[model samples]
Target: SSLTDKIKLQEEDKSENKKIKSFEELEKETRESSLKTLDDYFKFISELDRNDWFGVFVNAISSRFDPHTNYMAPDDKERFDVSISGKFEGIGARLQKKNDFTEITELISGGPAWRGKELEPGDVILKVAQGDGEPVDISGMRLDNVVKKIKGPKGTEVRLTVKKVDGTIKVISLIRDMVETEETYAKSSVVERNGVKYGIIYLPKFYIDFENKDSRDAGKDVAIEVERLKQQGVSGIIMDVRDNGGGSLKTAVDITGLFIEQGPVVQIKSAGTKKEVLYDRDAKVQWDGPLVVMVNNFSASASEILAAAIQDYKRGIVIGSKQTYGKGTVQNVIDLNQFVRGNTVGDLGALKTTTQKFYRINGGSTQLEGVASDVIMPDRYSHINIGERDLENAMPWSKIDAAPYDTWKKQDNFEKALQNSKSRMALNEHFQLIEKNAKWTKERKDAAVYSLKLDEFKKEQEKIEAESKTFKPITDYQNDLKFKPIPEDEVVMQKDESFKEKRERWFESLSKDIYVEEALNVLDDLQAKPVTKGEINLKKKGVKSK
Candidate 1:
């Protein structure tokens, strides 16, 4: 049987090196790699018989309505809660299947894997062993199975034999612990440049635990960070929401409140209802200074809401990609079991239904068009089609009457500031190289297929590798600004040396970031403008106001 063949190929000792020559050998090797841990499939399949297949059937039907809507079983709902909260019992590392290897994408801060200091991004996990048991070779195994093998009860140990990017292998033992998704939270850094303090807050997502009373929204965290930055006397703040896939609609509105005084944050149009304008009732502005919000094609929902609100109100200059991810529609999960009045045969799952669509205060829906950047910059995904329109069965965009909102008084010269940024970005060599790299990357992605012929393949790979070596200068770009982590995080950084090293590398990358540099330039231009525009405060917290 085919299963027997798969099992034989999968169970075979992968350590036995063989020089593959012909196409037939290559095909065999691929199958071996793809089916390396074949028993996992059988084990997983055998356990899935009890799952509610009807839920999947209904979900398929529901997906046709919109991509955001879905069906969730009880377990799925539980897992979804865990994902949103960023709290789960595991080794604490994000993994993705790449080139037939489950590679570590990112290590969570202060987690078990981070504490172990052995596992790292780009390390390919080859095998997983549970508490001194037989190490299960996970090479080419399904990601689902790999996760199952790795995730066990808290306090249990899981050993992973990982092949590093350098091609060396090492077995690392990590104890499973509760890794609270600290990465999802807001983190700030003070970048001092030319006697000016600029604050940068990186918000990975608009995360909040709706079910847990102890968990706070990301907006609260952002406010705290803003206060800290205010304490440091930052002239401007760069709220980076680059790849943030939005969450917590309430939190998005709350975060926008931090910059502007008060007004309509976002407009919602649910079925059979008038447009609902969510207002920030608090009239006090938290940060009455220049602000720049960073977003990309991956930024969606809550991210788009905040960016769009800031743009509509002319409160801050939106910078980065041409537009954000166009996901304006909202979905609410409903328990399917509630519909069954009588005792059902089994527990039915919940349905995540598209109940509403959000629009900007100025009336344009961010469904398909998203929010356009004020200072558009060249990014890796600028050319790629990765927005709401690109998604299957996405809703069409519509417009409504604009909500009443006042522009930030001090930003009367905002247009000139944008032009100044554009002029500078045009002359920057770093941005030019980035644009070139984006084109090159797209072309490479288009022609990624390799010739199965060994000689031809080897030559092509060599050519690519040689080309890669030429990018040294651009990759090595560094700025004079020294980025310092917030004082609160310093204690944790000191305890975990690896975390500090990771933070150091991140800071170094930020220094090289042309976008951030341009944003800083934009902030400077705003400050350089006429003082008569508005009554703005640019002084430090301790300084006496004139």
Candidate 2:
């Protein structure tokens, strides 16, 4: 059977395979199919014009200076702008290429595709047609070309022929509109454990709108979320920036101010210039209770700055991976068209290049050594080389004079909480398995050579699969904590089923997160005990009493 037919049969509802091919036969078939696909891909690439190749060449040259520096074409620049702003005029369905077919990975919430409820994730897009026009087959087409065909001006119709996961085929029509990427914004949820409520704020990026000041930005949105969480009577808050690849620098500083008293947050230095410290001058602390900033290996730039500042001031416990993504340098996207005058060469796109470097208030740069978590957690990527230090042309780590700041002294049990969390991690069965899996993954990565003989390959795969079964419980482990949205979100969820579904999925994931469970435990340990009137009187009299 063809790939499409096989996919239809295998993924159909209540379907089962009638026959199973041997491993060798299946492997041989896959190899031949993949080779033909590769041949087709190269053939398509061979027909590209000079302008397309020029764009690639320009980017290749720009990358030699640094990994972050790049030359974006006109279309690339448009996409970059949409990403930073978190909005775009399109059908709002994210697509990925699977072999020769275009697969819908996600439908932006509240957008046309999602609101229509016709298209869904895992549905294969077979054809696209512009408003009552002839349909064009998208098979074997470049992903970008397919995207171009689907996205159009607002209110315009785009008809897509899709193969549903249940082996059904249908044509869905959607009107393009301004779709907001809700996942890029900050959202909060409340979870209670042991009679105390905790707020979990997930900030995917420090987004900002340069063109419109009134538009929603990360700083404003997160501040609003913090206020909402406070209204829910949360005793502690967890700011989760895990996998956040960073965005606006100003938002990072603004967010840091929410937890701490007015103080220096980060430092910046350009070539041949003295260091300048960015401070959060606002004296109004939003939430003064126990805090935890969660981060992982993918947290970079703005995320690192937030974690580093929190760590420096002892305002919160940094928990998650050993260190972050280590991207301390800043980038500025310069419009290339500004350099040209009265030219007919069309759109020149832009250039994003390294500008300055950022440092923690304590003086150390997060360059090649990202902020170290106070309570390190074991993850599958723990043993992998995935930080700035592993990348070519990455900046080196350095230090400067520490900025003037005061450490948080209100939480006297900070050290105790840190020690308790570390001890818990050391004894956690799930974490132990994660550590073992990480080491095993590293070993497999290192030992890449394998026998080509079918029997030997089958035997090796069987042995590896048997060994991997030991770590299967990691995915099945659940902390069983229930998370609920704030009252405001609950109201919106009542009117929007899609919004409710998205929140439920997030809550389900949080319930299974052991790291979050541990963070809450640390928060529990950090809770201050109520002082008695006698102790207060003794303190007032300047008398030391037990």
Give me the candidate number with maximum TM-score: 2
Q: Candidate 1: where is the Cα deviation over 4 Å?
A: 1-53, 89-178, 211-215, 487-506, 528-546
- Model 1 residue 147 distance off true place after TM-score fit, in angstroms: 4.4
In lDDT terms, how accurate is model 1? 0.77
Sequence-dependent TM-score of model 1: 0.77
* Deviation in Å, model 1, residue 29 alpha carbon: 5.0
lDDT of 2 by residue, 114-233 (tens): 778688655789878899885666788877788989988999999998876433457799999988777667999999865678899999788888789999999999999999999999
lDDT of candidate 1 over 1-546, digit per residue (tens): 122223333456376564425556545755674464476655655665445556647767987989878888777787776665577889888786665679785677657887676786557798898988756777656565688889988999998877654333466898998887656678889987656788999987887776785777798999999999999898889999987878899999999999888999999999779999999999988998889999987788999999999999899999999899899999888988888889557777677789999999999999999999998898655666766877678999999999998888866668888887787667666667667766765665466376866567656755765665554455566555578898877887999886677567667668776677778777776774433323222211211111
Superposed on all Cα atoms, model 1 deviates from the true structure by an RMSD in Å of: 8.2
**How do all models score by TM-score?**
0.77, 0.78
